[model samples]
Target: MLARASAATTALTDPGDRLAELCARIAGRIVFTTSFGIEDQAISHFIMSRDLGIEIVTLDTGRLFPSTYTVWDETEQKYGRRIRAATPEAAALSALVADIGINGFYHSKDARLACCHVRKVEPLARALGGAAAWITGLRADQSGERAAVALESWDEERALIKFAPLFDWTRAEVAAFCAAEGVPVNSLHAEGFLSIGCQPCTRAVAPGEPERAGRWWWEDQGSAECGLHVGPDGRLVRDQPE
Candidate 1:
């Protein structure tokens, strides 16, 4: 089933057309998760403008920058539709917070991943429940670990097909599309923030660093991810790019 979907989109050159066709192929069971970053905003624009019927969902980590919320609000107004919100369960989040103070993630990688599990991954799992496919704004050039990203692959953890429509898209392409389409992007992007996540965990990247360098910046260079799109074996499944 997943192979058939990938094959259907293989020949498409345009991202908007690729996404529209994928949404139609999967119909009501597709979910697109956005974080209001440039890439996400571009995908959101395509989905809304085409009225593709794919549900747009966002995981509010509760630690996002104020600018991110500004983009989100503006996006809602522009599209005249609410993006579905998914969040961590209260009790679970409280327990994790209590065990390791709210800022404990700064102390260790384990603490950070635990925090991510509570604040991002758990909520995402709930958001993706019963969906046939999940979409993300991931790009191969973002980080070394993500260098081999596939436009389509099966997600073992989520038990569904994972689609990265922008896997082959460059940062320049994303910036151009957002600018041309008037997409509402996080204002922080102007400050050298190529990638945006929680305010506390992310920072502006140095000129020579990877796009994902800003995320989890304090950690070791290669350990920047939050485990959302990573497979159980710690690598993204690679397939031929569309």
Candidate 2:
């Protein structure tokens, strides 16, 4: 399936066409994860407007901003479809918080990654269960870690095909499309919040900063990843072994 999808859609210039073909090929077996960012809104618009059957879902990390939830409601209203919610395990979260007090992630990288593993990664694993294709709103220009992203590839860990339809699109291109299409956008973008994540871990980006600079700004790591989409080498995996 991975080889076939790559060969059939790699050279396609139109994102809509690629998505259409993907939806046709996978049909009810595909899932799309959205954070309601500008890029996510664009991809959601394409899927909804084109009547694609990819299931839309989001991880409710319990630390999101109110504006994020508002945009999510707006998206459902505009698209006339409910996005599924994935939550972390109750016992694990309670244990972690109890052991480290509410914000232990600030103390060390291990704690931070552990929080991400419980809140985002584990839930995402469940959300992608039995899915043949996993759709993401990742764009190459968003960060240096994702600079070499491909349109389609295999995800060995999840055992599914990963498709990033907007892999080649720029932030400007996404914003323009969203404005023209009237897609519901996160209100924080206007305030320079180029990347939105958990409330405590995110902030507005400054001038001349990368798009994801706002996320995990307190950390001094080389990457701002949350462990959900990164490989074993601590980089965004563009190509997975088939």
Q: Report, for every candidate in turn, its global Cα lDDT versus the true structure.
A: 0.86, 0.87
lDDT of 1 by residue, 1-242 (tens): 44346555878878788888887676448999999999999889988998887899999989999999999999999999999899889999999999999899999999999999999989999999999888899898888888888778777666677888898999999999989988888889999998999999999988997898898888887757897977677666654322
lDDT tens readout by residue for model 2, 1-242: 44457467778877788998887776447999999999889999999989887889999999999999999999999989999999999999999899777999989888999999999999999999999889999888988888888888777677788889999988998999999989999999999999999998999988999999998888984799998778777767677536
- 79 Cα displacement, candidate 1 (Å): 1.1
Location of the lowest summed lDDT over 10 successive residues in candidate 2: 1-10
Worst 10 residues of 1 by lDDT: 233-242
Off by over 4 Å in 2: 1-3, 6-8
C-alpha lDDT of residue 17 in model 2: 84
Score residue 144 of candidate 1 by CA lDDT: 85
Off by over 4 Å in 1: 1-3, 6-8, 239-242
Every model's TM-score: 0.95, 0.95
